[model samples]
Target: MKSLNHRTKVVILTAVMFVLLVAVYACGILISEEAVTGSFLNAKRPPCLEHPFGTDALGRDLFLRTLKGLSVSITVGLVASLISAVIAVLVGIAAANGSKWVDALINWIIDLVMSVPHTILIILISFALGRGLKGLLMGIAATHWCSLARLIRGEVLQLRSQQYVAVSRKLGKSSGWILTNHLLPHLVPQFFVGLILMFPHAILHEASISFLGFGLPPEQPAIGIILSESMRYLSTGMWWIAVLPGLTLVLIVLLIDKFGDHLRMILDPYSAQE
Candidate 1:
C-alpha cells in the first residue's frame, strides 16, 4: 500500500529486467532446437506464437539466438563496469592525493584518453589487441575509466578539503588510510552512479564492435552477431531477425539506462531529499 521511493522503484524495475533476462536465457538453454516450433519449411518466418521473434535465414530460432545474445551482452557490461570502476577509484585517489605534478600528469592523461572518438578508438584498440573477447574487453576497459576517474577524483578532492581529513593529516594518518577510509566512502554515490552509467556504454560498445565484425566471434551467439547475420537477409525479407534483436538490444540498454538514472537520483540523497 505504501508509495514507492525512488530506490524502491529502481530496485523493482531492475529486478524485473533481471528476471526477464533470466527467463529468456533459461528457456534458450533448456528448450532444444527441435522442441522449438519454428518450422524449417517456414524458415525466416515473421513473428508468430511458435516463434515469437521468428526465424533467421538458416531457419534457426531467432528468439533463442536473442536470449544467448542478451547473456553475452550482460557479460560485457558486468566485466567492463567492474574493471572501470575499480581502476577509476584507484587512479582517482592517486591523482587527488599524490603530488601536484602527479595530479596534473594523470589528469592530462584522462583528458587525452577521453578526447578521442570513442567508438573508433575502441575498434582500433581492439584490433590492435587482436580479436575476440580479450581484445573487446581490453578495448572497452581502455576507454571507459575516464568519467569514473573524474567522479572519484572530484569526491576525493572534496573530502581532502574537509576538516576531518585535515585533522587526519595532523594526526599523521597515512595517506593510504585517508584515501581508503575517508575519501573512498565519500565516493560511494558517485561510484555507484558511474558504475550504472557505465553498463549501457560498455554493452553498446561491445555490440557495436561485434556488429562490425570486430569483437565477438561470428559463430558466437551475441546481439551484435545476430544483427550482423541479419544484414545479409535484410534484402531477402528477413527483417524481423535483425529488427527484433536490435529492438531487444535497444530496450535492454534503455531500461538499464533509465534504472541507472533512477539510481543516481536515489543514491544522491541530496537530490531526492532536497
Candidate 2:
C-alpha cells in the first residue's frame, strides 16, 4: 500500500540520519586530541591534501578540532534537550491537570520566561550558574522548555475532553490513572518530535553562549570557541581558519534540523498522509 511504502521510506531515512549522527559522535571520540594540538612547524598552513581543514595560527589541526567541537556540541544538545523535554512534559501535564490557580501560575511563569530574548536569558542563567558545563546545561534546559510545555499543555487539555477520557472519568478513574494510561501514551509522538526539534536550538544556543565567552571553559575545543578563535586570524589571509570550521558547524546544524523536520512529518498523522 501507498501508506506502507511511505512509512518504510520514513523509517529508512530516520535510520540513516541516526547512523550518520552516531558515526560523527564516534569519530569525535576516536580522534586524537594530540593531533589537534599546536605545532610550530605546521602552524598557519592552508588547506591541502595533508591537512584538509588546514592548520590554525597555533598549528592546531582544524579538521580534527572541528570534529571534536561538533561532538561536544552534539553531546550538550542531546543532554540539554532531554532535560528540557522532560521538564516541559512535567510542567505541561501539571498545568493542564492542576487546579485553576496552579494552571494560572504555571502559565504566568511560562509567559514571563518567554518574554525575554532566549539568548539573553540563557546568558544570564549561565552567568548566574558560573559559566561552565553545568551552567550551560542548566541555562539551556531551563530556557528551552517554554514552547514545548505550551504545546504539551494544549495537547493535554484537548485529550482531557476526548470521549474516552470522559468515559474514564465517569468510570471513577483517578487523574493519575488517566494521565498515565491515556494521556502519556497519546503524547509519545509529540514528545519525540519536540525533543528532536529542540536539539538544533540547544546546539545553536550553546555555541552562541560560548562564542560570547559565557559558556564552556576556554580549554575545551567547543565549536563556538574554535570559531571565536578563528575570527582573530581572518585578517591574515587565513580564510580556511574560519570558513571551513564555520561551514562544518552550519552543515551539522542544518542536517539535524532537517532530520527533526522529517521526524515531525513522520510522527504527525495528518502530515504523514500528505
Candidate 3:
C-alpha cells in the first residue's frame, strides 16, 4: 500500500474514534438496570473472568455501571454543550451587530461570567436550581458560552469590516438580509468546531458537580456518583470500583478531546492544506 499521508491517517483515526465513542454510548443505552443490579452474594468480588471490573459493595457489576454512568454523562454533556453553543452564537452575533451600548453590556456580562471560576459558578448555579439533572444542565450551559461568544464576536466584527459586507451595506441590503446571506454561512464551521470542543468540558463539569453532590442525584448512575461511592470502599481493599471507572472516564474524555482536535484540523482550511 502507498504510505498514508498525514491527513489520511488523521481521517482514519478520527473515524475509528468516532465509531468507538458511539459504540460506548449505544452500549450504555442498550444496557438496562439488570446489567448493574446488585447481587449480595457477589458483593465486593475482585476482578475476575466472570466480572471483568469486579463487583461493588452492593454487588453491582462495575463495568455495566460505568457504561451506564458514562452514557448519562455523555447525554448531559451533549445537551448542555448544544445549548451553550447556541447561546454563544446568539450572544456573539448580538454583540457584534447591536448598538455600542448593547455590545458593551454583553461584553460586560461575558467578562463577569469569565471572572468566576467555572467550578464555583457551576456549583452555585446548580445549587440554586435545586441540584438535579435540570440544574446541572442549566449550570453548564449558562457558564460555557463566554469564551466561544467572544471568539464569534471577533469573527463577526472582522467579517463586518470586509469589503463585500460594506458593499452590501452600500447596496441597501438590510442588516438581517446581509447577516443571513453572508455572516451566518461563514460561522457554520466555527460553531460546529466550538460545539465539539465544548463537549469534554461539559462532561467533566457535570461529573465534578455531581461528585460534589450538586448535580445528579445519588440514585442516578453517573460517573461522579460511582466515584464518590467508591471512596468509602477504597480503604477496604476494593480498588477496581473506583480505579476502573475513573480511568474509563478519563480515557473517554481524552478520546473526545482528541477527536475534537482532529475535527478542527479537518475543518480548518489552513490546517487541511498542511
Local error of candidate 2 at 83, Å?
Answer: 0.8
Which candidate has the top score in TM-score?
3
How well is each residue in 1-274 modelled by candidate 3, as lDDT tens digits? 1587778788889999999999999999999888789999999999898989899999999998899999999999999999999999999999999999999999999999999999999999888988899899999999999999999999999999999999999999999999999999999999988998999999999999999889999999999999999999999999999899999999999999999999988888886755
Q: How accurate is candidate 2 locally (lDDT)?
A: 0.91
TM-score, cand. 3 vs. native:
0.97
Question: By TM-score, how accurate is candidate 1?
Answer: 0.89
Off by over 4 Å in 1: 1-42, 271-274
lDDT agreement of model 1 with the native: 0.82
Worst 10 residues of 3 by lDDT: 1-10
How many pairs of residues in model 2 come into backbone collision?
Answer: 0
TM-score of each: 0.89, 0.95, 0.97
Higher-lDDT candidate of 2 and 3: 3
Give per-residue CA lDDT, model 2, range 1-274, as digits (tens). Answer: 4556676687778789989988988898788878777998999999998899999988888899989999999999999999999999999999999999999999999999999999999999999989999999999999999999999999999999999999999999998899999999988988889999999999999998998999999889999898888888889899998899888888888888889988887877886555
Better of 1 and 3 by lDDT: 3
Model 1: per-residue Cα lDDT over 88-114, one tens digit each? 988998888789999999999999999
**Which is better, 1 or 2, measured by TM-score?**
2
